[model samples]
Target: MFKCFYPDQYLDSTYQINFEQLYAKGFRGILFDIDNTLVPHGAPADERAKALFARLKELGFGYCFVSNNKKDRVEPFCEETGGCCVYKAGKPSPKGYQKAMELLGTERKNTLFIGDQLFTDIYGAKKAGLFCILVKPIHPKEEIQIVLKRYLEKIVLFFYQKQKKEGNS
Candidate 1:
């Protein structure tokens, strides 16, 4: 079964998430993956991303980016987006996620993780005992390795949808 890889919630875009509601629910920390999860891969943090982080801050939530991308990419993005980051994060392993939570001074029960990848982001966050939200990739032009993984993701997602439709999720 693909249950372990299944996200706590699957949504169309990270922009569509109701962070206010999440804050009201006592989720004070948010962990994020950069790249397609925010802007397109290799793109810098834009005004939209900056605004969103500002809004999250106003809502009294702390955020940290957990990215597999090297420090060169993650550091500037994190700085521009108004949050901290753990670069070269080995995702699909809970250590990075746990470290991000520590940086934010958050507990597992009050943290959420959002990203575009299932195998890395969702699985790692789940292992770290954080709520995971899987968002559709922002752009389709990904690296060959990710493109290959998307094919497998589709099969797991098919079953995930079926389970959700049957109200078992």
Candidate 2:
């Protein structure tokens, strides 16, 4: 029942992801979550994020930022990082993911989604049939609603881990 929330891969941070390997594996595009996924909540893109985007571009990967935040918050960050973005993206709804794929000019099978939240990110990506990667949130500080979701996520994660251990993944 919780299968849609399970990430294809989990990592400590976006830095740990091997973009080169993903490129070789036939992933041509990526959709990224901004807050907590690329930086601390409400934080701007940093040097590290810039470099990562540059590397992705060099590797011929198309990418876009898909965030639930308003345009004001997402636009400036994407401007700084040189990325296209769709703000106010009501994730877990396929519209946002579809918009992102359109921006990347990629089909679902060739696209991947990376984010920190299982419910909003992983579930949405899975529903859209895109490969999903979950990264640990960059900071602990979050809105009360998200904090509560994190707690619920832990329970789902426990079962996901167990399933993996049993070779059911």
Candidate 3:
């Protein structure tokens, strides 16, 4: 069961993930979270964020942005990234993942979903049967809701780590 969350399926900071490495991993497509993952919550896209969008395009990867936020909240970034956006996506419900795939017109076997939260991003990806990559939030000050969730995430991660170690042994 622990094998469901493979170590290689995660990325530390979004910036640290090599686009080439993701392609090598059999991921021909990517679905990304807009707020807090690409930019600080409520902030516009930074230079690095814009570069990442361009980089994905250059790499020939099919990508989309699936955000739990409303249209007003996600429109700018979606425009900046030039990726299809699913507003009010209600992630952890698999709606966003399904919509993303529909927009990309691809299969889950060649796709990856990237985000900064376990409850939403990770869980949604798992439920959709796609590879999930968790990245650290772009800024700690961005979302109060995420800050609250992190407290619970620590406990869950602790148990997951222990379980993984025991299973490997």
What lDDT score belongs to each candidate, Candidate 1 first?
0.94, 0.93, 0.79
* lDDT tens per residue, model 1, 78-150: 8897778999889999999999988999999999999999999999999998899999999999999999999
Every model's TM-score:
0.99, 0.98, 0.89
After superposition, candidate 2 runs with Cα above 4 Å error: none
Q: Which candidate, 2 or 3, would have the higher lDDT against the true structure?
A: 2
lDDT of 3 by residue, 113-145 (tens): 889887888888888888777777777785677
Task: Rate residue 114 of model 1 by lDDT.
Answer: 98
Which has the better TM-score: candidate 1, or candidate 2?
Answer: 1
Candidate order, lDDT descending: 1, 2, 3
Root-mean-square deviation of Cα positions for candidate 2 versus the true structure, in angstroms: 0.7
**What residue pairs are clashing in model 2?**
none
Candidate 1 residue runs with Cα over 4 Å from true position: none
Residue 95 in candidate 1, Cα distance off native in Å: 0.3
Model 2 weakest lDDT span, ten residues long: 80-89
- Give the per-residue lDDT digits (tens) of candidate 2, residues 1-169: 7898999998999999999899999999899999999999999999999999999999999999999999999999999988689999999887898998998899998999999999999998999899999999999999999999999999999999999999999
